[model samples]
Target chain A: MAATTLRSVTTYDLKLAAPLALGFLVFFVTPLVILLALSFQADPQGSRYGLTQYVHFLADRFSLGVLGSTLWLGVKVTALTLLLGYPVAWLHQRAPGWGKGVIMLLVLLPLLTSVVVRTFAWVVILGRQGIINAALGGLGLIDAPLKLLYTDSGVVMALAQVQMPLMVLPLITALSRIDPNLADASSVLGAGHWRTFRKVTLPLSLPGIIAGCLLTYAAAITAFITQSLIGGGQMLFMPMYIYQQASTLQNWPFAAAISIIFLAAVLVVVSVFTVLGRLSRGYTNA
Target chain B: MLLTRRNLMQTALTLGAMHAFPGLTWAQARPLVFATFTGSWEEAHKAVLVPAFRKATGNADMVLDPMLSVDQIAKVTAAKNNPPIDVMLHDPGPALQAVAQGLVEPYPVEKSAYYKDLIPAAQEPTGPAPFFQVVGLTYNPETVKTPPTSWADLWKPEFKGRVGITNLNSTLGTGFMVELAKMHGGSESNIDPAFKAIEALRPSLAAVAANPGQLATLFQQGQIDISPGNFNAIQILKARGVPVEFVAPKEGAIAFKTTIHIVKNSPNKELAFKLIEAALSPEVQATLMEEPYLIVPTNTKVAMKGEIAKALAKDHAEIASKFVFQDWAKINEQRAAWIERFNREIRV
Candidate 1:
């Protein structure tokens, strides 16, 4: 009787899961398979198949430079988001009632706005005669307006703000999951508040930190709009380069090859970071 | 007449056939599909050209699909056997590429009544250009007391950190590059002199604006005193009382043509040709040259007066003598490599 019931339950689970599995096959797996095949094609129309595209990308110095810039941007954005998000998450975790709600709302506000709108706002704020320069000039900080737009720092600043929410939500969840009693017990044992936070709270929040970093890093690397708007086409990142190649130049084969390389590079970086994160967590726990 | 299952199935089948063959049901009506620019260009066409074309041809059914030029080309190329677009409006570069790729059919010169009236420079073997926009030096009159007379004046010491330039990815940038190449003894084949000249002007540049809007904003905000840009953008800003002036430099401005072409294998080729003809007609051209659309009419038959005359090229002679045209087909091949090189070497 028990075995029959178990078999029925298993069948029901499969029936429920079928739609999602089918969706993955159709939407995700199919496109990826097509991309992989196209990456090997010799021409834009895919009339012939060869490894020429991949070989060209590997040999091209411009392609390599773009790859380096993309990786660097991803790292910078990840670090900055973590630094800004961690404190906001900690404060929100400690806030009482209405305060918590307000912080949460503020954290989610940027996410509510369109990425394009947010990036444009940054353009307005960072331009030569923009708000920052105006204020600085008013205060007599300098005689000349500093160049901000069309620079790497401008791209990083916009991307960090755009990706802040992804980092904060995971962090807040991780911090909330830690028992308050652990902090109380540490305090009772005469540990200072700072020490208690450093030892207990920080270690407990490792999972969330790692999750947020990975998510933000991945997004930063693939970001197209922010880089395009802020970089002003002067700061060439991989995604922008790929877009130019495919659309303006109509070099689909080259674009596909670049995309494959970009995906591989992202995977390798994420894997290395994941292993490092695990090792750090283990050490902290011990 | 009876409410039987077989009768119901037959009725459903009949309805489905009607749905699928709506055009067939109405043999006299088939909508011509045209792919064109979005925003103001689309608005201008809908307001004037579409209705005028319909009235002239006695075909009231037409559909305008607004998309970016690249997207339009991609759609036509992807659906080569049966193109979704009957007519396509694009810049000269993409139009040449479309013709080269066999995505578009050449206009029938004999069929067009206004073809002879079109400015000789506007006449292309592939198609007739309906309008042209010139790119030259634009500056803030308030900051620039003495107007810049030449393109080389951008690098003058007084304009240091007060000039804005577009990156090489844009048409304006490409034009600037060509102008520089010409001024410094280099030509189309060799742009090395142009690169050196641009590198020298880097210190004077406030920013490399990616688009015209950004350049306009920079001018409005007094972030830039001078920049190389198109007359249309400068005119738009001047209309808004932005204290900007468009200057035709001594070395002539780059004239970029906006052209229309009939897509190959179009189901409505005749209607498409008619529409293109209507757009190029003196009546339609004159109306489009008015406010909100300020496009320079290519038809010599169209008369201009007042501010429009001052804003546009004086006549066919001026257009022939003052405007510089590039070999877009040849330039497009090396454009990507040139842009990458510009970003790496000159921008740095």
Candidate 2:
């Protein structure tokens, strides 16, 4: 038994884990570690390095404000998604037996298509010569074209539309887990329908909502191609700013510093989500 | 653990034997990484440019790394320590901006071969720094019944809302703005007047875009009445069944002669410069400019089949007189501040 325990894991291991682990270390971890390391170094001319790179990021007012913008967009997108998603999820839960299959297919359709194609569809619909503009123009709602494509409202609407499905799926799963008989019992016990929802359904579904919010916020904050394509180079959120730094400006240290700051903000958002989860008793850590 | 002990020893022996007799290895060891901006330009580079270069240089295992100019700049800057791209095709702003950032190294010229063949204006640095290509205004003839007689024609009420402008954040758009401002008697040093002028013309603008294809689409649909295009973009649009014509606008489009400098941080500078040397060659320069990807060549005499070079040459003298040569050396650093101000002032 002692000899068996003493044997090298490499000598006895039967899987290909070691080689794949090595590949991940070389490909993913090394690049990230290098970037993390370089973010700290200062490059005044962008030709050489010191610790001033971080100092520069810290020193710049815009870089500091990037957090607020990112968080504001994230929270707004999440909240809007939740408001729009809950009803759709409720509908899914309350669907008739025959309608269930069709609704299920409908709910999954947007997920099957590419985000870019969907966004382009929105662009055409929202464009000057597009459907909405044409319809609005015909109705004499506004004299001039309502500037819809490149506004904050446009960004939020588009973002929420894309994220609503993510919010709904998890919510439907959570809602499905709640026993309908429990709600019936609560109502029979003299609780109103609204009261039953407040007391049971909302509380029970909080886990999925929190998980979904975290996922949406994480995905929304890091968006690049979507924002670049749709933002019209005007409504630059933190991700767009970071991308311009990393890409357009070609300042890796500055870009990495911005990313590091963003990463820290994401960590705080996650921690807050965890705290919310724990306080509500809606999530299990395991 | 899976392999027998004998097999392991045999593997080691084979590896050792291969290492010992290196001359016996017939396989080429290096990967040819050629990068260019994405879209039709990339397709052309892949279809014709890279293949021709490979055939000429005898490099067969070449890989194309198609990316946006921004992405290419990032790679060149990030991999400043060691670059993946052996050759790259970039615009004037990025190429000049790279030089300003010290990401580019001076390209040594072969006096007789390069100096004698390059156009007088394109042969030397146009600004405080050197550039890779001379950029100017190009419009399609098929779209214009009466071709724009002057640079100021873009602002005429007839072309209102049919003109596609680029994003102000980009060098291309900013360059266009600066040129327009100069036509209206303002300078890049005071870009405010230019911005105000552009704002006044916003009603006439179709869209502020970067994609050449978007402009092409507008032209194809007859939505774009006029386009302020790059010399190559005009050529690309014409090839795609778009009724387009190019002009050297009356006040003359700005002339930005570009240079092909070796990226300072590239790992394979020796091979890169050889490619650069090929780029400098009159034969290659002429080929790049006169064919499917019709860029204006810097070389004085490459060979223009018939009307191609002459068409490119039309209005050359007129556009040259009033051309605004941008001072990238100073402006490159101030670009961020200019862009910030532009963002604050420009309507979203």
Error of 1 at A102 (Å): 0.9
lDDT of 1 by residue, B14-94 (tens): 878877886756542357988878766788899889998889888657989998777788899889988988899887667
> TM-scores for chain B, in order?
0.90, 0.78
DockQ computed for model 2 against the true two-chain complex using alpha carbons: 0.23
lDDT of 2 by residue, A1-286 (tens): 6786686756756565988888999998998898787687665345556667777767777666656776887788888988988888888889998776677787789889898887777677666666877899899997877656656666777888876778888888888888899899999999998999888788888888888888888877676655555556545567777766666566677778878778888999899998997876633322
lDDT of 2 by residue, B163-275 (tens): 76656556666677777666667776666677777778777766555344455544554445676676666666677776777666655555565444456655455655555
Per-residue lDDT value at A60 in model 2: 70
TM-score of each: 0.92, 0.78
